[model samples]
Target chain A: MTDFAIDLKDVDKLYGGVFSRRVHALRGVDMRVGRGEIFGLLGPNGAGKSTLVKILMTVIRATRAMGTVLGRPVGNKPTLARVGYLPEHHRFPDYLTGRQVIEFYGAMSGVSRHERRKRAAELLDFVGMGKWADTRVRGYSKGMRQRVGIAQTLVNSPDLVIWDEPTDGVDPVGRRDIRQMTVELKRKGTTVMLNSHLLSELEMVCDRVAILVQGKVSSQGTIDELTVHRQRYEIEVSAGDSHVDAGVRKALAGWLPDGALEGRLEGGQTLKANFDSPHLPALITVSTADAQPVQPIIDALRNARLTVRAVKPIRPSLEDLFMEAVTDPVTGRTLAPGAKEGA
Target chain B: MVLRQTLAILGDAYRELNAKKMFWITLALSAFVVLAIACVGINSKGISVLWWTFPVDVFNTAIVSPALFYKLIFIGFGFKFWLTWAATILALISTASLIPDFVAGGSIDLMLSKPIARLRLFLTKYATGLLFVGLQVMVFSVASFLVIGIRGGVWDWKIFVAVPLVLLFFSYLYCVCVLIGIVTRSTIAALLLTVLFWFVLFLLHSGEQSLNLFKLNAEEQTATLEARAEPLSDQIAKSKAVIAQLSEAPTDETAEARGRREGELATKNASLTGLELRQQSTAKDLESYRASLGRLKLWHDVLFSVKTALPKTSETMELLQRVLTSSDETSKLEDAEQQRREERGTRRRDADAAKRDADNEADRGGPGFSPSVVRRQEEINRSRSVWWILGTSVAFEALVLAVACTIFVRRDF
Candidate 1:
């Protein structure tokens, strides 16, 4: 088993005063994320996803409970050194150029000046922002800024990277590039904690995911485990005339000797046998004037004695799993997972 | 590590100052102030009129060049000092929005996620504020000197010393405003508080001067009684009779007292009545005098008991020292050792007080200003424009910044 990079136990976060009103951003969340794994936190708007990320980063303290990242307590400065973060609405000094921002963040993380310069170039290139590195961030587009945000996150070469809505404004191409980069980061043994509303992207990149609804984690698991209940199977068959059916019945005597035949008339001189389970293949017979035309196997079935139906297959998708997890099984109102359905 | 962190913080502060529009605005304001002052100085008619109103004879000293005299006049009147202080504070408040902006924009998340400590970031912003203030002061001094030299044809190198002192004063104010900015997280609130503080200090200084005048007038009037024909006993008897008669009548005290008290009693009654009319005037004046003696006691204590119950400067310093020393376990031990030295000094003072009390206890000495009277006299003598400006700015900024930082650091943002 891989080491757990981030472990949270019954963490709860309440914002605002103790006597006044508060927003229960995270309610008893328990999460254990494995090392070198891409874990996606999927939720709708105001679903406590960002709150969880903030708690992990120590930007917002958990009102009650315990958590650790990379063996250090959450919010520990030394631990922060091994962790990189990109907030949902990340903004840098507009006066600073892309290169300067990266260098500044690198310097803040205690990276040497020479190393910072080299890494800044490399990261700028990695984010496909090599040309725009020298240009001020004021002129950069949203997608470009998102790219720089990604670069900044990797500047520390942190063991764990937390990204909140990293692709909110990113175009499809940029999103794909980031997804590829995330996969690459995972390959390099970095644990990525991603908080995103984009389910499709999460499905593409995440090995496992947790869905939050109404300030609590509704469900969490691998995609396959979540969708196993929705699996299905199918079969197809052909039919033949009475004479051929009688011959087929004689041929199938050994396979289904005692079972009563269930038949349906399709067209002239045609019979189709249907069985539920543990059924065996049956035989057919045909007659013709010429020796070539006397081939019964094809002529009997093609002449409406027996004919094969079309065959098709289906499999459950991530969307199907998400819908099942989010929706109420009975009323289908998208209730929280594990909540009892109202009769 | 501290030095490195300080440097990083300084860099961060510099970056923040560079981004703020107030930095430029303050620079422009400083230039304008210097230019305005230079215009007033170059026009001989304006200088002559201004000097005529002041009591100083430096204005008439023939040895001093007109330009040198004008520079001295500017320094003495604190035109540059006030301008720099006001402009720096205004600019600092505008720049104070830096941290709040970062919080609002969610950039703090990215920043805090780095290895740098939060305090370092805070201190860096403060240092950057000072840097901006320093730049503005330099600009103002250089501009004022150039304007004066071209217009008044005078150049004295002594004026250069004033530049550093002015910058130092501005730095003190800037540090204070930055501290306020860090604490309050609202530039508007910080700015308002700084301005209100300056106004209150001005009122206090003016109020103290007026009270001294009234005290002097009372003293002079009391002196006249000794020279009058009436002996001390007869006058005392007359004062007692007037007090006894007035107790039975519901007459306006001012008119009654004026009619009864002839010379010394009249002056004493007027000053006493003045004290009674002003809220906490008597207690405050006494406390001010005591504080003015040597203890540096604040007037707030005399005016309001409940307010005084809150933490005072010594308590705040203790808390600050505790926070710094206890930041790490190893440093805490070192702090304990240093605290021992301070205890020794306190013990010595206690011993001295015990010795004095033993010797004086049987005497039952009449009421008088305590032994620290000399210290008080010195304080009163030393109280001047520069001292008032320095003391007021330091106290006001320190309090503002401390409160601001505490609130901002603890706040959710």
Candidate 2:
């Protein structure tokens, strides 16, 4: 078994063939999920997030894929016993009760009868659906169906669970329950791969995340690793008498050799001095996660008798990383959502 | 694992059908039919409905044994009309959405994500489509079995064969339904197309049967005509020999002898002319029959070839009849009816002949029927091996299912 719960290498999916219209849904993607972590897969609509998940689940065959899910080759049927999946917009037969739906899928996953029945009861309660377990799905609201969907996913006690929008259509309370469920599943050493559009929710719970744009992964890492370069310390100061820009520029003149200071610090952190504000306080920014690099600037402002109003450290949010991934660098606009056409 | 999955799907199918009001509705209808069958009784004097007796001379117990009579009714009306046609249509309407619902976007993804192989999952789902018919037929057959046993005074286990035969018959059409359901993914399209396919099959089967009847009748007529012509031809030759011998002048013959010889020659010559005319007429009849036989055989062969490649829905159900009652019993019933009709006199005969003529005219525009024509048609049908009937049909179903499965397994749900 591999150390990773999911190790996908060079995965590719082409929806249609040469003679027909084609959609290169997934490019050559290489992704890895650690054994016991919540890996969030964030992307825009049609960005191939679901396509990649389905390929791993064997719901859609890949044009070419090399990976292992749950320590077996991708698309291996038996290995799916250890891998649970809750598809987006999943539909259960309306005739069945919520409990029956769970047991049915559990049986399909090759879980024994007694075990699945026991787990189904427990999972239903775990998802807060125990009260409605015997209710037919036909009578369920969308949130109820979502709760049952999550319950069915864990019925087999899978080691790796892939949930595509687990909180879809769920109420806030139910969403929190699902979030807690993932954490509970993690506490038991289960790998959870979440694909959702809710970046804040993922930011609250995900341990690591991959950002896919136009069928390619733009970046993938822990939140800190991804936002490190964008992390900065900003020092806002004011001249008690005169314009803040002039006071700040005059105070930092020694720190600038050519009347401007815009370069990397000695420790390879980016540094820029801003003095263009006429009415606002001039700002000095350092592109490093460390606070020590900004202390000297704070001391220099104090020595110049310029009041240092605030010195704050800032780090980019998950939404910021997501937006940057989807936005085109040259166009300064969001890239067209969805997989690119052609090969 | 496979067994668990199979049972799970089967259980799901039962629940699905259980939820459909049509399933129970069809079952209730079946019970009504069985009860209706049970209420009708055959006494020595006549046929009875509950307490009331309507005397049917030919169909009475004196003419048909109660066992054979009830068997015939069950096979003809119950099995053929209700189970195979009416209930099958009901089952089709109830279960038509099976595959389309299965492969619907949200549903199929969950199934495909399961650990079961795609082919197994697809085939199991397809089989569940037949489950509606299977349950309907099973309940109907068991009920009919008890009806026949209690009312008819015979417990024929062979009556239970309807379960499998009807299931097989339903599957033939259900397979087509599944293939269309997979391709179109629309319940209405699947149902309508499957019914159309069944109609085509029925047409082909009926065409082949009608042509075979005509062809067999023509062959029998040709044999009869040939049999009649032989003696007439021999007599004509003898008359010619006698006339030729007499036509020569005799040496030292008296006038009376000559006159006698001339009279004899004239008689022989006249008889010869009459025989030759009859021979010509017989030859003409033979030619016509042979020509008709040739044409009938050609058309029958064409339909037979086409029908051979398709499922034999009627013939498959007919197999249950063959198993339930022997030909001897059927023939006895037929002979008693024939005797009763013969007692009615020449008027009945004339009407029968006129009807036969009309029937022959209707059947491929051919003429004639031997009493053995019906039996000959039965013989032709019975001549088909169970293997050929079911095997080729299943082969057709398998082909359609294979195509459906290929699409199902390869499709990106």
Please report the candidate that would top lDDT against the real structure: 2
Candidate 2: residue A207 lDDT (0-100): 97
Candidate 2 C-alpha lDDT tens digits along B1-413: 99999999999999999999999999999999999999988998889999999988778876789998889889988999999889989988998999999989889989999899999999999888888988888888889889888989899888889988988999899989998999999999999999999999998888888888888888888998999999988898888888899999789999999999999888888889899999999999999999999999999888888888999998898898789888888887878766654455445456686565454433322345545787778788888999989999999989999999999988888
Per-residue C-alpha lDDT of model 2 across residues A29-105, encoded as one tens digit per residue: 89999999999999999999999999999999989999888788999999888888999989999999999999999
Q: Candidate 1, residues B59-131: lDDT per residue as tens digits? A: 3333334555555445533343444346645655665565456555477777667766666665566556567
lDDT of 1: 0.60
Model 1, range A1-343, lDDT digits (tens) per residue? 2278988788887776656656677778888788899998877667678778877776666788676789877767777877888999888888788998888877777777787799999999999999999999999999999999899888879899999889989999999999999999999999998988778888898988887776667777777655544443222334433343444454344333544353222221222344433233342221111233223323434544444443223356666665665676789787643222111
Off by over 4 Å in 2: B239-278, B345-367
Q: What is model 2's DockQ versus the real complex?
A: 0.81
The docking category that best describes candidate 1 is acceptable
In model 1, which regions exceed 4 Å deviation? A234-315, A329-331, A336-343, B1-5, B28-58, B63-71, B77-86, B138-185, B224-403
